[model samples]
Target: MTFAKLRVRAMMVALLLSIFAVGGRGVSAQTNAYATAFTTSITYQNIGTGTANINLTVYSSSGTPSAIPASTLAQNGAGSYFVGSVSGLGTTFNGSAVISADQPIAATLVQIPAAASQVKNRPLSNGFSSGSDVVLIPTVLKSFANYTSKFVIQNTDSVANDFTVQFINPANGAVVHTANPANVLPNTSVYYDAGTIAALTGTFNGSVKVTAVKTGTTNPGSAVGTALELQTNGVGAYASQAFPASAAATKVFMATSLCNLVIPSGATTTFYAVQNAGTASASVTVTYVGTAGSTPVNVTSTATTIAAGAKASFNPCGLAPNGFSGSATINSTQPILAIGKVSGAGLYTAFEGATAGSAKTALPYVRWLAPAQGGQQTFIAIQNVGTTAATNVTVKYYSGSGTLLGTHTIPSIAAGAKASSNPTSASPSAAGMGVGGGSAVVEGTGAQLIVVTRVTSPVTGGTTGEDYNGIPFN
Candidate 1:
């Protein structure tokens, strides 16, 4: 395996469709204040046969470009499924997008943060798979107070590139900051504003190991081709997080749908930031799954190493008890990477756990429109890393022009276990499924289960969030 280690092991086993935008809203807030505005959705699926219309192009990250739009995906007769959304595109702007279809396609490009009331709906999942070079962005920040992170790079190769954006320091990997913004012309895309970098400009919190090399080969070839991480709390509107080519993971699934009984700390407390990215030093095991009689604790701290690439953030309710809510599964002998943040009452969801539970059958087609349930109210969590129990487990619901809104069967799910509900409390809402919103697909014939999709919103001390971990479709 050489050719950039087989494209970094085929981009650590697939996922990353290329996208970046600042779109509408004066870009520049989050430290001195509030800045939010970014939404890029480009979904595709058309094996081949009947109808077809796909051609989307947008570039800027330094490759500056624009012009080419022809959406019309309406052919589910044999191979169909087309989603579109690429208007204007301005704001902080730093882009790269290309979608041309003749048939054979299965794409995804998502980025959220367009609405606001208080702003608390963070969902990010970026990638670069097809045999990699360098794309391992576990988490990068600059918290001196709340939070501030924004590092976008897009060269998804076709030619020109010259990358290198280090920024390590996960506890002691060194490299405070490094830059080279302005030589990414392939599909085009570039942006680095860790809240206005000044070689870190002060209190630097990090982890961003990009490497697009291979134009002349010094090894890390292929000149860094993908990365999109947008963190925020400085004031809201910066959603998108999921850039892991190989942070390693033996198992991880710590999700919560807020069982509120007063657990406030900053949105509700349920964080589990575990990042090892291996090289040696790992050792962990925390299991906490409650409700069905509750009793599966194990995790009083002590017995958690993590130190290779470094990163730690715990509070899984200490692994159950004190107002314990639900969901927990972290097992690592080494090969680790996790993320789970669930804010308090006003609501705010943060997700990216289950580095191996597998994102919704691995990209099991899920669409959102009709406001994805209008004000927002979507829940679905299924964990069963398998050791046994997993009776039937199937969640199928659709609506939003696709219509089908039905099917929901989750009888058992023990083994390592987990099962959050919402479809009128897990199977019952009949043909209206979750009521509004739209799109879903979670299967199980044998059972290994791993699905996640939250999405609350109402504000004023009620709800507010956005979650994800269900993208697996090759």
Candidate 2:
């Protein structure tokens, strides 16, 4: 398997189509502070088939960007907004880059801000509204040992920007380093600290892509937007938790290749096994037992086939199943959400706290959008009310009074899929409460998941937010 591992498995189907595109925005007020630096002037007119009308104007770099007149700013069908939601301008900006497939295209942009601006200044942003197949990787990574690790890349755009680092070598895709236009100044995030670049002594597994470009676009729009090579061997997880199945398959939930997750052996020692593929092709197998359920020797395998509402993963290394004695049986019919990634050999550990009322029901985490650290961070809105797809789901955060703060795990979501997360690094203290307080029941033997929680209170004027349909809240 080479060709960059078959283009990293065909780029995981465009990373599940940008997580089934609804638009992302999570993590509010974490406070890294890169304030005051406006002068955003965007203009792109293509207006026809796949469409493109975009027009933006923001000054303050010195002011006079024409005094700020893009027709007062507020057009609808192509792209024009003074503010609608770019969420705190910390950056999430996504893309699809199409401009001519038939009509109605719009990778992103929906403004309205100017009422003195304050959802952290409101500039709002979106470039591939659904067009520009944005993929630009300008690498420079360097860490095979001194290890401190952070190098993240997920600015699914809603303001705050800066992500340009390319280094491709998924084993022969080769590119090495080619992302030199760095400036994620808007939404706020860009990472560094593997000692500071330059290490990997030998065998080299290569893979590095940290893209989010739209500062002056000279064209970095397709070929899946190239750049994804930063592999040491790959596989690093711990942000998946969701287990709830027994309400007689919650209403109507399809997706059953087989499902199981018992793990009842004297309580915590080592546990993690998640496999979700809610039906389309069906392929499942996972087992581990000790408390009398029997089946031990420990195993791991991850085939694939869950198109109804896709998600897949099978992990086992801690050991305790060659014959078994207590409990852990997951036969299959579709439904497996287990979590306990906790290992940080290369690094990325944080979040292993909330179970608060844990009776046990799948809880997944790994859906992020960062850059807020003031309100104390607390947002949860994993809405996919269930008609079919709700694979590996888990979203837990609190503040309004319940106060939990941390937990996110998402793998599959399609049916009605809505997204939002704030596993708290900081910024939200709490808002209206309701979302079942902090929400995280998500069951699936057959199915169940329809979470909600929107808290944003770092004070200032204290109110929080919500958007609906297109999905947005902080």
Candidate 3:
């Protein structure tokens, strides 16, 4: 990949880190229930062929910056760092960050709440490489089922800009409310709470679109953002990066979907929200492909229609058999964006669907711990989206210092099929991998693949967890 592409990918990773660094409060200090503190662990893998020297510049919400010590990683290796443990940033610190690397890398950030808070939710998001003038958020809520949504938008350009947020009703093509345009400083972020919007009264579930424009002109400006849905009465939370207009597609793929999959904590199910991004109404269909047995069982959604700027949702809970685990593909007549949420027994996670697959993908966080041990463990689901079956699919695990831990292989994966791996059962297990977290890279020879990873807290009978999309090496 060219230097520009690498930088774009790395920037995406940095965008996510900045989100939590600022506590999603922009220039102000996070407060009250929103003030829940978290320590962050960042995992990054060098996707380039050469060694990488990575540096981070953390910017406080006030725009003051602190330079973090540099770290190095070998080709295809991975490394990690703890943001809260770093010195110099006093307590109550909140801000944005920028990452610079000599070689291409993919990164993810995991936010763990302080023990005192007893918050089990472990929310995560992948880095964003670039920004856009317009962004789409597939799902947003306002006092709906005791849940609400919040978003933080960062201006990626060197100049200040004004952003307009429009909440669109999914049932009809209408703008329920439009928040007053907010002006944000360059390289800084601003937060919006749906609960605070009086126009968005009780029980509202819909989609959101944000547009950034030059401070004094109608010309488009650059920005990136992330949104989170929080359970008002509990600790449940899930996050997803806002989708740029360019990310909308006629088709989208989700690597993993659960339909009443019984786990220690509870039965799991996945629901998807598809937003119509085009000017015209959209005709959509969702196809679920089961991966549980020898033969694949396919289920399709009824003909659904969504008005422009609106969103439609469907779940496999009642459509698929109990204990069903599978993948989903969404087809639409109009360009659309999609996001999936997996929920059950206190576990909540949201991930953006893939508009396209890559030959290789990077997973920045992977963990493993025995069920009885009671800690976080990760389950990875990879889908072969290529025309032909994928063969010689391999995953390489690397330690925080870039040391090769071990490799796991999936001999062959038929096209449109899925495969999975669990670090707890890794072959030729590497020391410390099961107890300590690491990073990994998945490669599918001459085939395209997409990946989604689920991290469950407490190993088994976990009450909270999160999911994130694997970074593709463009």
Number of the predicted model whose TM-score against the real structure is largest: 3
- The candidates, ranked best first by lDDT, are 3, 1, 2
User: Which tens-of-lDDT digit does each residue in 279-376 have in candidate 3?
Assistant: 99899988888844445668988879999999998887666777778898999999999999998876788888998888888898887656555567
Write one digit per residue (lDDT tens) for candidate 1, span 181-263.
53456656566657677787676766776667645545443432322333344433323443545545777766552333363
TM-scores for all predictions: 0.34, 0.22, 0.89
lDDT of 2: 0.28
Superior candidate under TM-score, 2 versus 3: 3
At residue 265, candidate 3 shows an lDDT of 83
Tens digits of per-residue lDDT, candidate 2, 164-260, equal 5545453234444454545333322233323234544333333344445555564332222211112223322111111222111111211111122
Model 3, TM vs. native? 0.89
The full ranking of all candidates by TM-score, starting with the best, is: 3, 1, 2
